[model samples]
Target: MGGRLGGVGTGLALGGGLSYLAPQYGMACDSFKELEVVLPNGTITTASATSNPDLFFGLRGGGGNAFGIVTRYTVQSHPIGKFYAGTLVYVLDHSQAVLDAARDFIAYNTNPKASIMATYEVLTTPDVLLNLDKFIVVFLVYDGTEPGTAFRNFTQIPHLLDTSKPNKTYTEVAEMPIPYTAELSRADNVFRIGAHRIEGAAGLQRPRELYDRYAAWAAANKGLYVYVALNLYPVARSMTDASRARGGNAMQMPDGPWLWVRYILSTPPGLLPGVYDKVQASFRAMVEATPSAPGLPLFLNEAAADQRPLSTFPTYSRLQQIKRKYDPDGFFVNRTGGWTFD
Candidate 1:
């Protein structure tokens, strides 16, 4: 049940894992039964509910490198079967429609069997002719063979591509969205996230405006980035229920049925020294403009290096205490690049 639907792996403990099965089960971090890591003072130890319980608490949903380097993880396992999932790519002309559909899904969806991630991506290379670069890609997954009406809203939209199929393995479902590893690693990457509650019309409508604004910003400043994308991740009530059932996570997440809009912009190989900073600042400001809903926890894995994702956690104060206890002298705080505990 613990996997990259929210993170990559054992590191998920730090990032607060949100899996495709999060609604049915719980976050990936919630699956951890035990972990062995090298603590700040170079002592190797184990963390679990009955063992180094304090470390275990802080380690789940707490950002990494500040606590310890986890060498092994003993996680709870679940039965799995083929999934119904795929990716749908829509033309920019369908942007508003797709966004509307996504909003509707977020507002009312209660199905523990279904999961979706909507991303509007813009290719920023100057030579990429036409408006072909603009498109929206959605990842839909149903735990069973038939989704029933869970994804009706999305499937109704006019899309340019559809890859969803029945009876696919968990790994295949994860791989539906192709990984651009080389391009991602070599680029200048920047990420920012905004969490919002799924409220009435006004609250729900805000992200649509934010989406339009993001696209316009990327379009105006083309060539400065290899690509800029706006991704929408839903936090359903079922997901929260599952997380809470497992004694809650380090985030101490409040009630769910919310949204996290992830902002990602990557610059091509090189940019003039001063230009890079300015562009990044602009991107940061754009995300900050929307802000997160009060009491909501931002996803650490998707957050920017400069953002204080930990501060948004309801467990902030206690996490600070645990941070002081585990790395007393602040060696990790001084040496590593992560959220500030102070």
Candidate 2:
């Protein structure tokens, strides 16, 4: 779920290595049957999906610290039981019927073990008569149970809080109160966090113009940032048919069903030197007025380090010819950091 799915070695890598269940169990390098790596010049090797197999299709969803360093992996583990997870809180006046019931449950839910991660937040109110504060947080999961009619229209909305939990165990639904904060420099430290994310893949439409482009970037950067969040998750097709029966990885989805959009920002690291350039020009004008779904793919560890992620992988020219056939002379493309292969 976090740890960018093994620190971007590809599983759920969207904080930097690009993955979110790898289109459903096919990302963390398609459950690497083996690894080992080393190269750059230190040369130790081993890959799988049939031995080197194009560096095992460029390490699953490519860009996990940009290849050659793995030193052991051999994944593929699945087997648990109880399901139906938790977290559900709503308020902003039922947020447009919870964003129209998550755009009709990811465009007509068919229940592929139903899932969701909806959110919509805005905060900042010094009480000069309360300036702003809104909410709609949901983090559901239904491997199956708890009135699971594929999340009965988000459990019939009208919620102010609904701590759902029944037949749990994905490590007890990853220990509830969900807001995956992996030790952000010791929690409870005011705000000042910047996760200005922008993910596309808008299939099955209904981007709802990304919540009217984050309510016009929170009414033009309210209070210079203390909270602002947006997210939605769904990408079924049985997780891309179980990542194409495991013979295909390197994330590429557009045939159908899709949705993944993120926009997060929080401030107060002493208001980052007085609202650093109107917060990067209001998050690049709300990512140039959000809209995408053309070719899908794009999640690469939640992009924005100058956003390239193997040019949004449609196998980016066979992952740049498998990174010049395993670092021909690039040495893991000049020693580290990912999304390379130009």
**Winning model by TM-score:** 1
Question: Which stretches of model 1 miss by more than 4 angstroms?
Answer: 5-9, 126-130, 179-185
TM-score, cand. 1 = 0.94
Per-residue lDDT of candidate 1, residues 1-342 (tens digit): 556443355565568877778878777888888889899888999999889998888888886676888888888898999899999988888888888888888878888888888888888656366568787888899999999988888889887788998999998876665433326558877778889986887788976878978987887888788888888888888888888888778887777788888888888777888899888888888888777888998888789867788888888999889888889999887887777676
Error of 1 at 273 (Å): 1.1
Candidate 2 lDDT by residue in tens digits, 1-342: 233223223344322232323344644445567777776767788888678887767776675456577767777776557876777887766777888788777767765666677877776544234323776778776765654477778778878678887787666565555443323423222211111122343432345666776767777667776666777766656666776787767765544356667666656455455466568566756754654544666666565555564676677898787777677777655666656866
| Poorest lDDT segment (10 consecutive residues) of candidate 2 | 187-196
Whole-model lDDT per candidate: 0.81, 0.61
**What TM-score, over all chains together, does every model reach?**
0.94, 0.34
Residue 184 shift from truth in candidate 2, angstroms: 25
Cα lDDT, model 2, residue 252: 58
Off-target runs (Cα >4 Å) in candidate 2 are 1-54, 64-89, 92-110, 125-132, 137-148, 153-155, 159-226, 230-244, 247-263, 266-300, 303-325, 328-342
